[model samples]
Target: MYNSNYYIPDLVEIQRQGFFNLLEKGIVEEISKRNPITCFEKQIEIFFYPEYYRLTKPFYSIQQAIFYKKSYVSKLYVPVQITDRKTKRVFLKWMLLAHFPLMTNRGHFLLNGSARVIINQLVRSPGIYFRENMHEIYSNKWSEKPSTSFRRFYADIICLKGTWLRIECDKDFSMWAKMKKGPKIPLLWFLLGMGLSEKYILNSVHKPMNLLESFTKEIEKNQRAKTFKELKYPYVSTSKKAWEQIQKLFKLKKTLRKSSSKNTFETKKSSIVSSSFTFFIQKRTEEKYNKNNETKSKKRIKNVQKGDPKQNSEKKIGSQLEAHELGRKWFSNKFMNPRTYDLGKQGRWSINKKLGLTIPIEQTTLTALDVLMATDSLMKIEDGFLEIDDIDHLKNKRVRTAGEALQEILSVGLIRLEKSIRLKLNGNTKQTFIQKNSFFNFHALISTRPMNGAFREFFGTHPLSQFMDQINPLAEITHKRRLSSLGPGGVSRDTATLAIRGIHPSHYGRICPIETPEGKNTGLVNSITTYAKISVQGFLESPFHKVYKGQVQKTLGVFFLAPDKEEHFQTATPDLRLTSLGFLPKNPIPVRIGKRFVRMRSHKLALMGVSPLQMISVATSFIPFLEHDDANRALMGSNMQRQAVPLIRPERPFIGTGLEARVVSDSGHAVLSKTSGYVIYSSGSKIYLYTF
Candidate 1:
């Protein structure tokens, strides 16, 4: 421990109300100050931007590798460095200003995707993982049930125990936290009503019980602790032989080695610039090999309609019925005959009167909202809904439900899952669980140390391990050039720019509910719902996709979860996959048209436009696209609207272990029950009526 003379307050209440300003100033200053190799501010985009869009979840974009040391500076970017260490004194030393040149917008690069490699590696770096600590935090903030969307950390470091580096690979940054700040820079986030957080605020308001206060007592009960098990708080117990033994075993030392050599910084910075072109770091090369066995997975999406990716930019998609005519008029390569569909331009006001609406209804979405409108008026749809976990079909794995089934399946190979468990098969015996052979299951170190004393239930081990061994996705943003120099960074129009998977604005729409029929006016008339839209004429199937200013996390139907594998250094990985069951109706609706497609409304999530899945979820429910540091739960609390419940609340069923959806209210932001159109694949199935 350092001399007691210099006391920097154990917890520097980070109390400077002008927080956004402070952050803005700090970020701008940092980026500008570290120009050149240490570029600070960047647009901070994901890999590529899709032309079409929707909102099953924020389009997936890996954090291409980002490299910067203390010295290099000068670039247009907002630099924010967050490092956790044992001492406040050494924290700043580890900060790095990252510069990402590519995002999800422009799509793939010939060379190995830089961001993907870096993010994965950083999070997976080996070190003493504070797995238990990260899981403890997750549990306190989120439920144990495998959430469609959840947060896990990659890595973190602690100074104690001889300059220890504790990477809690289990904790993933939360998009809920990231989306809070009004649309500003990509990473900049606002802790709206910082005191209103479920993890801290609510817990702190009623009674002031911090982590240390509650757990201190039990940590002492078992005095024969291990090296890492030193009690984090003062415990109420008499000093005894056991205590002596624990002390003898854990002679914690604050490791304060000389600052990492300046050369180390230089090497990393050089690597940053060198990385832009092509990096052959053994570190990088070997890592890719580890997952060489992994294959690119594509889901067997049924109702998915192929897109024509070569339409002219001037012609807005879904604008005219003769879109096919336009295709022939424009591109020599013809695509979807605009006659059948103008790629996601349905649900619009129509001069004709076949669809049965006064004006025209918005058919711009493929969501539950669309489902509510799309299902034949005569069909009876249920009022209540179930959670649909976005599952990785190839990886036949079930999410962690609020039960012992997941663990049982993991350990014993399967659990009892019967269709009529509640009736014929002795409800208890009917539950069936089967395990597959392909899940990348690993035992995590974080799961070993139990932070919450009694809550460490029997099946806690696996969760704890999953929390620790989760892989870290290392993403690198390679500037357009392999080694583009500083003085000049300009982009040419149509010269694809790098951006994360984000949603294109809903197809330029005059109204929503373009497809849904109007009812007795709530004082509003001559209007239809503006369906979630997309311009799918040319850019339909881009790797990444998203919509902008989409509804907040209204229905948490989809999730963008990032896993980490490193120890002590809680960074996030970039395996951004969408997880949520699309249709979880209590009364299973059989699909009429396609096996892959469902009975829901269909929206084409074109390149720029997001997937209908995304829009519908965001419009009515929650899709906390990004990740956050502290607000470690499903969403940032304010992401959901009360009215969004209907869309987010409906039932559903997916082909996997039974995992239902749950609803959560977010009192953080202002939202309303507004209807929008989405592109969904329509089908036939048993339907229930939940009419107003």
Candidate 2:
């Protein structure tokens, strides 16, 4: 009837709910969408077995172990079944053994019989984050007020695979792409490369269709008379031409450095500088001269006001092209690889080289095109286009889903997917196989050894597995517990505790107040109350009073006995009758109801907001005598008693069992003997004693 290895009933429900939560999140749907033939059903079963232990010896047989070497081993295991949605067929049946990290009942695992708890962690959710900052530029003319510039916030798409694509815009409102050390490509071009539509990309970032239409109209109006063909189809232009267009779009005038003024003048006279370069230099020189004169005049005025002309004359003069002056340019040249320029210094370029890797853009495009063709999103293939090999394969094999194609690409290392398995596997093995790595597998802690036969028989096979057992019953049972702590990528204990203790408003009805452990883990380790339930939709719902005709009717209150009077009263209240008194305050005070008196604060009846009937149900459902003991003390008793050892001592025959009498004379002789009962009286020099 009682089995320690079997999962606790409440824990089983929680674990089942956790799996349903994943299903509700559409993870299975996503996987199925990617691999149409490989679908997953909603039905799942989990089985927990007892801890496994093994003793190995160098000798082949147990009889020969007298002089051979020996060792001990132990572990845990869980069995799982995954079924396909479309075919009503089982997809995978796995017996997860120890060495595989699975969630336990307490949100931890047992390793070598020692309990291990997981910690929660914080991770960036898959979404977009916007960032904006001020870009400050030095004043060109000190007297001319330095123009204030505002750089609009750009959108950064954090792909599900952890790739970051930054969308940068210039004064022309034309967007450019900047990945981690990747060149700046036109935004539209990059989207096309990813096999995504321009409209889809715009909608992903919340861009308005009206704004796009207006921008299109403006571009058409400005480029109507342009003879350049590339101007008409900028999105499809070559990278080099796109870069050149980006340059012309900004139209930043080249400036002559203050240090290069003499060189520029000589070059202008010798006709060494091109017309464009000459114009740029002259424009820069004029701007510099104006700035210097304005700064000097300001200094003179300030000096006159302070009566400190000598200090003004000593002001430091530095070259405009000094190392510090060109710091921004140098930094951008070395680190910022817009358009994939300066490949040698590009971070991704070097990384790719080191890994001997390259993205087969052509191959990716072909694959995308094939998928679109299969789905009829693109032009239909000609009737004779199908080759003999293609026709034969098409007849025998299921079409590869988009997910399958992507997975194949991933396997070839075309793109790196983010590591989702946070927990380490047994033997420190990094899980690379997606099939072996699952949402459930990542949380399961397994052991190899089978549980005791008696324990297995007592708990019996899981209901879902009973039919399978009828054909071939499992020889050994696997034990498992769903862990509560953070999985592989969880936060630390202190952080998790701090978060839980903060008591967010969302936890009001979802978490149980009475079922939390006492002391350090009080609120951190809590159990769901009986009335609380988690729905398949992933929301935790508890009972709430319903209003009839827009009015809440008065509810009767139950009487509860004080802790000291609990022994005298079998039930909290006599005959379980409702009292006229309503909810009472938290302060402890004596109250009379019917023919009994009790403390209102010390009992379940005093719980705020709960109806008397609900309170009675809660009290009855909880462990007996739990209300009488401190929560911390109860928790300590439950866990500590398991590790306690009983001691037995032998009694000594000489030890006294009952009352004894001893008499001593002035001469120093003493006698002791057992007495039934005695009385003594003193008369003159003689003492009288009687024994019965």
Alpha-carbon TM-score of each model against the true structure: 0.16, 0.29
- In the range 313-413, model 1's lDDT, one tens digit per residue, is 21122432243233233222211122222212222221112124443233321121111122211111111121111111101111111111211221221
lDDT of 1 at 278: 18
- Stretches of candidate 2 exceeding 4 Å from the true structure: 1-12, 16-189, 196-241, 250-487, 491-501, 512-531, 537-545, 551-692
Q: What does candidate 1 score in Cα RMSD to the true structure?
A: 35.6
Best of the candidates, TM-score:
2
Question: Model 1, 419: alpha-carbon shift in Å?
Answer: 67
Count of clashing residue pairs in every prediction: 190, 40
**Segments in model 1 whose C-alpha atoms lie over 4 Å from true places:** 1-31, 34-213, 216-219, 222-596, 599-692
